[model samples]
Target: MAGNTDPLSPRAKLAVTAGRAAAAASRAVGRGSGSVIGGKVALRLDPDLLARLATHLDVVLVSATNGKTTTTRLIAEALRASGPVVSNALGANMPAGITSALAGGSDAKYGVIEVDEKYLSTVARDVTPKAIALLNLSRDQLDRAAETRMLAEKWREGLAGSKALVVANADDPLIVWAASSSANVVWVAAGQEWKDDAWSCPSCGGVMQRPGDDWFCGECGFRRPTPSWALSGDHVLDPHGSAWPIKLQLPGRANKANATTSAAVAAAFGVPPQIALERMYSVQAVAGRYDVVSFMQRELRLLLAKNPAGWLETFSLIDPPPTPVILSVNARGADGTDTSWLWDVDYTRLAGHPIFVIGDRKLDLAVRLEVAGLDFQVCEDVDEAVRQAPPGRIEVIANYTAFQDLRRRVGN
Candidate 1:
């Protein structure tokens, strides 16, 4: 009797329970094994499940500190020029989230996944993608990612035995170093045309200098070689200072990196460079990243700020001051549990003072501004902040969770 009623039975009750749960989850995800809601549910159940699914499909994995979502989406769109594709439209980068994305599109011929830095190595091992694109690595989410070196090491470990074609950013030292270690690699660089900041060498802790737009280590002599695929041309018009004329719908230098990276990945896959550029020009705003919207007779630029690197890049793109800035901070599970990252952003660069601060953590942002010796108006309600802000050129910066909330508040 005791054996018959065992809750931890080897194959009977446990198998039944597991089967039922899976079936319910499948049903919840909807037909064809795909649904945003369903994918999210699957992730909640198991994080490594996506890697298991990758073995059955053609996968293309993209990882980076910034621009992973836009770059992943752009890659998917470029591939779509040839055939059907599947991807996580919401920028879910974890193992389980990737599985959720796959489960949603069981019929797709190709899979495009944006992998989080922390999980890239694990996912790469499990998925064994056909090709992997390593975009630039920047300092972001210090609480979760700790340091960029840690992420670089993990990527090296995960991609050790991968036979997949490697697409690397020649402009970035970390990417150049990673590609050097790989056997099958195609290097892509943004050319010496644009001016941007490059990080220090990961090996000797020396400054990695850029001879052109391409980088080299001053002390270690670990410079990146010339890229096989390069974005060349003089005075390549960056209309919005975000790398333009290639047809970028977003604003900021980060967006340009995303576009260039997408073009490189597409070219590696044999997509014509001209065709890729055409598609890039045809694309529109991607919701949160530098998306412009109309609100209350004012033009609102909604930019997502998830970490220090992203915020710094966004701030750098802002046109010279006099443009009012409205920043919103929230404690959404997605923006991370810690709100201390706000202190890392250089708020003084806004030209003058922040016109308004909103969201649940208004005071928190206000305190940060004060510590920086910058003046700001704090509003407990997002709507009040939007209502009170002067109508004209305005910049609205928000985290992942607060983007939509502020969007709705501003009637975007």
Candidate 2:
């Protein structure tokens, strides 16, 4: 159905009403992110509310350790060409968030949902999505997500039961293993520069080789799948060698990878590359991921990276030493209580740079920088850090709540 505007069933209607009331209450009290807590209450009231509202809608679920939020935003924007597409704009990927978006947009027939890595299986099993995009697996929120390998195993279990078409990143061995059991798959070569996550094959402890840049495991013979879509330089290429050039407002290799994977998802749903690419270029930011905002009265580029894999990619975007950069971290519930993943990232590469460390976890990062030989000064306050950073092109990278808190502070 193009537009499913029919009224929700009585149970679902009641759940949605209660959820809206909860959201209103939260907003009234300024207790939390209204998008999250309200939907949680609704799901508690009616566990099956999401399945009911999503029954008649076309759903596309995007799950990844790094790019799912931006990717979902891109896909959701592309799907709007068809009609209204439902999605949570905030980086809310849990069941509550999914229900919140659905309850608010009951009339929308198309959905582009960003799912949390650990919760993807449960959500997919319930939604039976029309398409699934598995970007990459890496250590993220260790306290909350357990480990990446366990996440991969859960994905494998989920895929065995999923009937949806999977758009998987073939560059990462972990993603290949997770989607290997899928009935329908469209592989995309959206580059994975960080090989730390794929140290040994996810399926086998066998050492993997890049035969023609496609990973192949030596022991159990698990291998990289051929990509039907990929990014060749600046152009998005098809399997038959045709290419579509995309000009993005968002920068970085990570974002390009996100855009290419999103195009593959769009293509699986019958959207031509041209249409998807056009909409992708229009996306400037996802809840302030790549926003250029003034902090301490100076314009600075903002980036969010919550884990090692993300930090590695974002670090690559840094120009060089003496280019002012601020590293912010936090150990909030949203950011996971464990800040140990900081040790996993190769901050040694940060040596020879002018760095200003900021956040509640700023001391922890400063210690790591001292060990890595990166000369950095610690400024616990966000505004103070901004005031002290070298006067020039400034870049700020913050994790989870640390980033949100800054966005809120500088928000006008």
Candidate 3:
């Protein structure tokens, strides 16, 4: 049975009970999911509530600028093949939300947590995971988060001398440098399409030499490690030299990349790669991402792109031109108040599509599109934009807050 409180101390048990009540109240009022508020209330009542609950479960923390939630979901699903698993399937990666999730799934044998990149160290200290997935690090929420290189450095410092087995991306130079200090690491050659952030070496601030798939810094002589797992076009090659075709229901190379690391992480937990991959095939949509919602007599497939790197991957996933694309962006606290990252994304790729833009920062996106020699219509909202579109299925791509707005609107 889930939410069993017998293992917790009296103080922690009371905290968990109060947190559940608050969560129920929040959902009743429709303020939000109540995950974060509930956790905050519990933590305030008991500071060590997370650590107390985590002591009974084998935890795994997944952190990355993109694909954190999806990868966490895949890892959790894979672990479920062995026993019960609990996770923050929603995009609430902070401490409070994580606490609430752990409290709800008290009896789960495995705890798969999706942690925000900025809060990874703090959460890692409390959870003491059995394994940690270090995915690619790139620019995201520049106003709120630190630079990618600095984040990599922080990860290196945080994981130093830790006992957890690290499953990391070998293709990403930043990821490689970050996980270098861990005693045990399983490197996976998950492709990095966005390389603007890692051209310079994080080690000696020297220019990195990238001849082909290999990368190395000339000044400090830091080089790419040999990956035990590598991703070829449509298949993943394991440490044993055997290749398996990655047949996931999810779309794009990015999701395929995510699946590769997920399988490796599941292997750390004693689940076979084949079994993990089989479980991952069932996860079609993650927190409304890649979810195709029917709206106004047309199908709208939602995709999330929070940064330049994310936008690049999203371009490949969206349906080709002729089909309308609704791009919504918001400059709220969640989306990063500074909209300067807009200029970093290449809007030219979307030139052929009939684009409909909406959101708080629609004007900012429209300006960028215009400068890139593209035509777009700035609509009042998603409903207006969809009603004005031609027909058939359309793609709705948005940033963090804007994505949530559309997800709520369509009831995804």
Candidate 4:
């Protein structure tokens, strides 16, 4: 049996076959990566395809404004303790991407899905995930996504009907509100380093109280649930109050939080804590989030900064000794067409650091850097910019498309 369920229905097999043919044709023509379009066709042919394919899989669906890609990667690795897993590892979190992942394989007993914040409810409803992980929600793709709380409300409404166990970040008040009524929950105090969007109660519209690890709303009685797994310093503590240090190859406290959250989801699936932690320790990068790529003999660490909150956390990942850093921005639809969010970031933190701005919106970044009193040179090309920087360990941070383009330039 594949994935603990019966074989795909005749309808599902036909849809998957057509989708695969379409994907192969698209790739043959040298079009863009055909992962999405293939799934789109398959889903169009079989409206109930995701549900049908996920029939017997122990599915874990992860959703968040940021870190969903990396977190999903981590969870997939951890589920290796269970069996083979199917997942959308290329950062496509929509239905098509998810359908494509499942369509490729029949041997995978588990499906780890990274769902976009806006598409979480739709996918979760169809997949009927065994565990729904609610990571932090914040401002992202403002032009594409609804307001932060509105998205949370949609999650709350969707989850109310789902019988899946909820694995959630207890530190994010917005996340707490979204998962407060889940039928079964494993609350984790994964630590929210960015709290710009979580200031009020989703139920009563009353300002919430944040006095350290615990937060409670006086008006609506909304409060931070006691955590089952909590992050204390660099370690993740389990339900029995046993703590283990996560030795992840990926740097930064943000990744630490992500690993801890993934571990909690693993526990919900009965995975031993050590097995889950061990698998996560080996993940060096998730779709170039913490990849160290080479460009002219320099080990340039690539990190994604897709939004203001993400930028704030990404800045912390950089060493403070003042090494040369490349900043790239693109205003493509994938990277959020509205580049105005550049002003929303604290570019001032970049002051006194050697900054080389590149990408389609390099000039826009240069203007922001200038206003922040940060010295930066506009480099039209990332590789050329890397060549000009002084020889040392390098950190190159970029938004969505810019990160992808540079990864290709660096030979992937």
Candidate 5:
């Protein structure tokens, strides 16, 4: 029902048509959702397709090392209270996928875009989003995506002088520096679990001082700002001091933070916080993340953790001791070819769980687990790993590509 309302130029229309055909062919051939390829084809036909398609819509861009896809989905669903909303719901954050998504939902009143951390500036320049959500910044895909501070600098430079309202996490120093340059910004006290990458001040390069919950730079005097919205335990407090209990179908503290941010962004677009939170409580999963599906006669709770920061959050979400945990890692290009980051994860926290390692980089993970003094069994695949468990239900934590492969294999 979401279609384009504005009349496109002759070339853009042809590009959209060609992109849809390419996507259809990809789905027919089982190569996957053809979103990237279709967008590639469409862009080849019209280089300015994204900018052209994004015109005349109130757009919101969500970018973060983690939770961008889930947050994007939540924002889109909440904005549905306004009208039909379009989004790249499959976790495709690049420009091509975004263009394809916009092309398909041309008539939708609102566009919720999930942008890659590196591509945020480019997409923002094209779409001119009404509100942009800047979640926490952490080290992820270091082989390709730049370090956290560098990304923060890039975001700061790119967003300078932009008129869009920025809703950013106040708990992260890197995010604080990045969103600081925006003219109109809303800071949310969404807690940051991974602090290793932000020890030094991004502003004056001074050693950051952390006294309990407050963080400040000794040299430059930059400190955590007073947040307009904050997450307190399971409740979200608005700037006016009213507290609302966050009841989301999604589990984990990370998702509660995401919901708080989503509520703030939705409010920026004219939806009230109460209404936005109510609308987001129904989203049980995003793409394939956190999906509990039946696989090999055992209930498998699939969790995606691609970096140390993600793994830290994932560790808290898994089943407790005695419940078997399967950790999958892959060194595919999508999962970051350099598996050295595996050493950064504290696998010893998974000490008591019956841990099983699987995937292409299972041996690499095994070595890290060995160094961490944890016992783990190396398995060939998910079925083999699940077969070794005592049946009933098991937890499976995987990196990006491995997560996708498992989702496809399990038909989830």
Candidate 6:
């Protein structure tokens, strides 16, 4: 048998197959614990993985409470206009997922990965990016993220020793503070303004008054400097009561921030503003984040609500309550280990009767809706709720896991 051996091509194929199977098995075993989020599993790897990947190409990291996925996708798309770029298109933001993306795209010239707030420190320490885009910080995942300030501090410490160019949202107080402390920083400001709950002076804990379009601390006199790249001079045409423009492809004020941030990052990479604007106009919404799909002769607007800030931003974008709203909430560990944050959401803005609710944890959402003095019907089946909802103007609010299930069931 040894004398008859030749190139051994069959054995080589078998070895590759076995290696893939082992990796898949390891991922499955790792997911048995409670560390991973979304469908991606987290696993430890040798430090050489990052070193090997870093030698392949430059990396860009985008992180924020909201708009990270959209901005990351946009930046990746814009970068591809020049050359090949690799990204975590499935909304993976943890260290394991980042490693998986990099390992999978060893040949790509550029890598763009969105990092979650809680995991930014870990990612920053592991992956030394060429540039880091730090979007605004907001109250999110209260259980997982102790507080916005704590996350900010972790981020500051994570990037303190790195040589990455920092692109920050200057309008955000938290980001402004981080930018001021960083030696190499580019500030990007969005023209649109809203009264956020957490915009205050980081140094003195005083109210940061908006003097004109810019924000300044009334007590301490600290203020954000004018951005190097700013999006201004356009009014959001709100034909409906919502503060969103009717002309936008994505229907929300939050999307404006995403668009402007994307433009800024693209411009930083030397893409012209006109090209960025055109790209923004042509961009499509990712699945489950303000994704509007047509099914059964009606439009199903699926918005993913993860935390109180996200819910508030989404609620502010919805047009005046259409008749018969369909709201779904799931308490599955995949969606969220705890559903107590539902209490912080203001469901009273849902101005209609008999709101249809569906999910494994419909009772919890129903209880919250009841406490808010809203009428709702508890349906365990999402398909049933989708079918039973009236034909006129349907808005489906789903948490992370339920959004995917709802999309699959609704054929969108």
lDDT per residue for candidate 5 within 12-55, as digits (tens), equals 99999999999999999999899999999999999989988888
Q: Clashing pairs in model 6? A: none
Between prediction 2 and prediction 5, which has the larger TM-score?
A: 5
Instruction: Itemize residue pairs with steric clashes in candidate 4.
Output: none
Task: Show where candidate 3 strays beyond 4 Å.
Answer: 1-6
User: What are the Cα lDDT values of the candidates?
Assistant: 0.68, 0.85, 0.92, 0.86, 0.91, 0.67
Q: RMSDs, each prediction? A: 7.8, 1.6, 1.5, 1.6, 1.4, 7.4
For 1-412, candidate 2 gives per-residue lDDT tens digits of 6453564677777888898898889989977668788788888888998887788788999998888899999998877777788898787789998899887776687878999888898898778799999999988877887578778888988898578999999999888888988889999999998888787878868777776677888888888777889988888997777898877898888888888888888877778888998988889888888888876668888889898889889988877777788889999998998988889989887776788998988989988888888788898677887788777778788998899888888782
Model 3 agreement with the true structure over 237-297: per-residue lDDT tens digits:
8899888778898999999999999989988888988888888999989988999998777
What does candidate 6's lDDT look like per residue over 1-412, in tens digits?
1122232244433433343455576668754222223113213324344434445566788998777887888778767766678787767677655655655554576788888878876776666788889877876544556577667777777778778888888778877775566678877765434346457777688987877777888899888876766544343221121222213477666776676666666666777555655666656677557677787667777888776767777777665655566777776655556788788787888856348988777888889998999877777685676677766767777777778778777766
Better of 1 and 5 by TM-score: 5
Ranking by lDDT: 3, 5, 4, 2, 1, 6
**Model 5 segments more than 4 A misplaced:** 1-5
Predicted structure 2: clash tally: 0
Q: What TM-score does structure 2 among the candidates reach? A: 0.96
- Among all windows of 10 consecutive residues in model 3, the one with the lowest summed lDDT is 1-10
Best by lDDT: 3
What value does the lDDT take at residue 84 in candidate 1?
Answer: 70
Tens digit of lDDT per residue, candidate 1, span 111-193?
Answer: 89998878777777887888898887766654566466766766776667779888887777666666666778877664322
Over 4 Å off, model 6: 1-45, 191-200, 210-213, 233-248, 294-298
TM-score winner, 4 or 5: 5
Better of 2 and 5 by lDDT: 5
4 or 5, which is superior by lDDT?
Answer: 5
Candidate 1 ranges with C-alpha deviation above 4 Å = 1-52, 191-200, 207-214, 232-245, 295-298, 337-340, 371-373, 408-412
After TM-score superposition, the amount by which residue 73's alpha carbon in candidate 2 deviates from its true location, in angstroms, is 0.5
- Which residue pairs show collisions in model 1? 33-103, 34-104, 47-96, 50-99, 216-223
Predicted candidate 4 versus true structure: per-residue lDDT over 291-408, tens digit per residue? 8877788889888999988999999989774788999999889877888888889988776678898999998988888888888888879778887787688888999999988888
What lDDT is reached at residue 98 by model 5?
94
